[model samples]
Target: MTTTTYPVRVDGALDDRLNRWLWLVKWVLVIPHLVVLAFLWIAFAVLSFAAFFAILFTGRYPRSIFDFNVGVLRWTWRVQFYAYGALGTDRYPPFTLYDVPSYPAHLEVEYPRHLSRGLVLVKSWLLAIPHYIVLAFFLGGGTWFATQNWEWSVGLVGLLVLIAAVVLLFTGRYPQPVFDLVLGMDRWALRVAAYAGLMVDQYPPFRLDLGGDDPATTRLERRTPQSLPSASPREPTPRMSAGRIVTLLLGITASLASIVGLAVGGGLAWLDLGMRDSAGYVTTDKVTLRTSGYALASEEVTIHDDGATLLRRLFGDARVRVLADDGLPVFVGIANGADVRAYLAGVAYSTVTSPGPYSTTYDDHAGGAPSTPPTELAIWRTQAVGPGEQTITWPIESGDWTLVVMAPDATAQVAVQADFGATAAALTGVWIAVLAGSGGFLLIGMLAVVLAVVRRPEPGPSTLEPASAGRSNESEDIH
Candidate 1:
């Protein structure tokens, strides 16, 4: 009996001995391969796009383009196998696009002389959707249209390779079973890739053919349907161990926690930016005070609302300073619009001075005495004696305010200096904390998820009925 062959074939052999620490550095070693592959893939995409139009028109894939694209895939596979892709080989991948027979990793695709003009338009995209969905879980999910900015998960195959690398690191032996499963996945992915690349017409099978060799090629000699050589009939599907399940669950939880932490940290950062002060102010406004008995001078200054949210207003701060030249004592107080008006209304004799639209000055004969005591909204107050200065700083809220300067026993000339500013360093600290915490959590979660997926259990062994029984029944019927 003649056997049929699959057009796409991918195979690899695990190195007998692997350097325990080499896997860690393979990422660095593959930089040259990566740089070259980057350009090759770009060409591969352009050529593939061109091939699509060619197939659409002529019902034939150009042989030269097909070979070159296949070579790109082949080169990529070898680098992946040697490094994070499979960790099945320790041999450094060569830089060439052509096949190296001595290299443990190999890939090939048979070119078709003719293709269906109708299928060419849809097969690579529409008809291949099912296979694409399956491959997403194995090779990492990404969008077809926005491939340049593709976001992919750490897929099952990558996770499995990572597990193999770690095992090799500790025990110095690549686990055969793990390698077999990883190879099977790689084969499946490549076959799909070939089909989508327009190299073959046959659809990729959903079956998991675990081993270094292609299962389809090996099954050709047998007349009966091929079954898994080691799977048991009772439990055909693979079962993950308890430890692996626990690990996956932990990974999932950690990922969720990390995502939540990122949100909270971002919110904190926004709040800090909105509330914290980024600039400082030093205002030196001149005011004259009468040295005669019971004299007071006041200046009304507008504190414009900066449109900050109520929470930010509640948390902000402003510092005020009052200085006098007469070397006597001065009493300074800040009162709101209503309090300033009522204080001036009750004064027996007073002079009013208007500096700006938002401010008004008042001279009082009662030494700044008010008909009623100051309101609680009076935000700040201080006393300056002699050449000494008075300073008061407090959390600021938004409103129109008045600066009241009064003579304490004697009159004087005063220079009122007030400073207001924000704590920007606090905002920066919050932002850094958010970024570092979220980034760290995300990194750890991704690693854990990959490891958990890789360590999942393999499917049970399959049982096959004897092929001779059908032959014997036919012989009995003939007799």
Candidate 2:
């Protein structure tokens, strides 16, 4: 066999005493791991963003960041191996980010001391497109079968795992061929993940090395004391403390929130600047108001007593424009809720319960029509009457208010198309402040996280050599 190896190695050894029915409940058992993984993946995204810049300018991934990222991948692989990815083992995965040697599943990525500065720009997105497409089938793509009446969807790896689980359930053994195929697919996905994550500069070869052991596992070691006279094992990478992990995660979450706030703030600024008319009024689409009664009235809208000056600064001028559908003289007015009720008392009218694009509903009040025309009423604070299109502009104030639209002659039937507008002068400044504040927070949070992740810990001592004298140079480097 051709011995080709990639930097990312994923291995999973099958358990000798496999539980037959445990696979069925593995989904329920893996819930805690999945919950923790969700947060870890978010932190992974934040760290990868920082790593991109570091790799771009320095041609190197920070050693501390590299180790932490590898730990995340290792943790994920162990969980996947124990659960659905291969169901190769029944041993539970540890909660820590560091690897456990006794665990059946392991992932190791050889750290690159120097990466290609130019390749870092395109490898993750533009160069990795082909593998992403291939993985779409292996991970998730389409339904297994579909008909007019029913459909069932499953990915290739999932189907294989299900088959193996069923076989193990009845025959007391997992199919080795299926396990090998699953391992190959999982390894392929992990390699792509590493490359696209900017952890490696080498392109992942489009070859499947099927089996539990990696193809690079060929070198045999002579571990006898006489055979290894000159060297000791390489020092293990320091593990990130749980407290540091928690702090990093909090920073990442804050940065994500800042980005979302910036986006929303930018959108509001766009609307405020680009959508207003010459009079500084942003208007809504015309809504048709119709009623088979003397008038159509809006629901009681309460304006809190926060002072008229503050209200004016917030809402600006409130304007309502009405156009009679039947080309009749119409009257539209805004009055206090109590005044409106006194005027419309014992008068047949509909209070618009809800207005929507497709349907409008009303709460009907049963009585006779008004005795006088709406234009002659003294209750209206602001009114427009006798027109094809009548407009009313009123300063916003603190009170319970209602809008009433009716025929000027108090006729039973009324139909009109109306639109509302407001000169919300405060929005432009509000959005600008939001953009500046969130932008600052985003930068600060990112800087804090990067600093924390890249901080180098103090080296304790050298464990790679024995405490004896006269060590010979004939031993091979264990790397």
TM-score of each: 0.45, 0.75
Candidate 1 wrongly placed segments (more than 4 Å):
1-4, 142-152, 218-479
Taken over the whole model, the C-alpha lDDT of each candidate is 0.62, 0.79
Local distance difference test, candidate 2: 0.79
User: How many clashes would you count in candidate 2?
Assistant: 0
Best by TM-score: 2
Weakest 10 consecutive residues, lDDT, candidate 2? 461-470
Q: Where does candidate 1 have its weakest 10-residue lDDT segment? A: 456-465
lDDT of 1 by residue, 279-307 (tens): 43223344433333233444555555674
